[model samples]
Target: MATYNPIRDMERFADALLEGSTRGPRRMPMDLYRDGDNYLLTADMPGMDPGSVDIDIDGQLLTIRAERTLPKAENVKWITRERTPGSFLRQLNLGQGIDTERITANYDNGVLSVTIPVSERAKPRKVQVSTGAPAGVDSSEVVVSEA
Candidate 1:
């Protein structure tokens, strides 16, 4: 005989509910990753106009909202329907180190790509070495430049 845990079952049920609520046509798929000096976010939004999408960053959270109005098909009847149409709202918690003001977004070919530029403070900095012998290198002789 196998033992059943009510707490574990409830947790699994809650997780499934959350996943189901975040799915559907209104809720598009998204992928976020760090690429070089920027954070890239790609979303799959088919049959949606670029102007209908809105992106907002508040504090350390990023929210994407979009709405789509489907055209009515004349003389068409559906026996089974799975596609849903409505407004969508998706939010992501960004790290405190992310620069919100430098974020940029673009929508094309049923896909949306957003690039958030990294701040100077969040980027890695190189440490300069002293070339001079005794009291470090002189200002006039040392030329420091980033690679």
Candidate 2:
């Protein structure tokens, strides 16, 4: 008995045709982690020019974009070629507690790094609690527990 999968067959066909395609855009690999009061994002963009990298924020979406260019080829025999040059794009959701105004980005050694600081209003703080208040105080009372 034989089974057929349309999605799997389509993926295999695409891979065979686009394995060395340099005309379409692709996703850039990235890593994101939290350190202290800020979040650090590292993206791998080997052989990419520093001036081609761009970082922007629209509403709650943070986007990273870049492009790579390859030299034009003439009439010659080709033996081996693997790397494809094209556009790279990545987007992330910046939820609450992000200091968007102070965000920063840097590109060096073919890698892009972005720093996102946490907002002061989202940081944890200590709150004092009181037992009984004066009788003259408001009729409504509230209580808190340190435990």
Q: What lDDT score is found at residue 80 in candidate 2?
A: 37
Give model 2's TM-score versus the native structure: 0.75
Clashing pairs in 1: none
The superposed Cα distance between candidate 2 and the true structure at residue 12, in angstroms, equals 9.9
| lDDT (Cα, tens digit) per residue for candidate 1, span 84-146 | 556676888888667888889899998999998788788998988866454765668876799
Q: What is the TM-score of each candidate against the true structure?
A: 0.65, 0.75
Task: List runs of model 1 lying over 4 Å from the truth.
Answer: 1-26, 73-75, 129-147
The models' CA-based lDDT, in order, is 0.78, 0.85
* Cα TM-score of candidate 1: 0.65
lDDT of 2 by residue, 3-66 (tens): 6667876876687476445466678889999999999999999988898898889987999999
lDDT of 2: 0.85
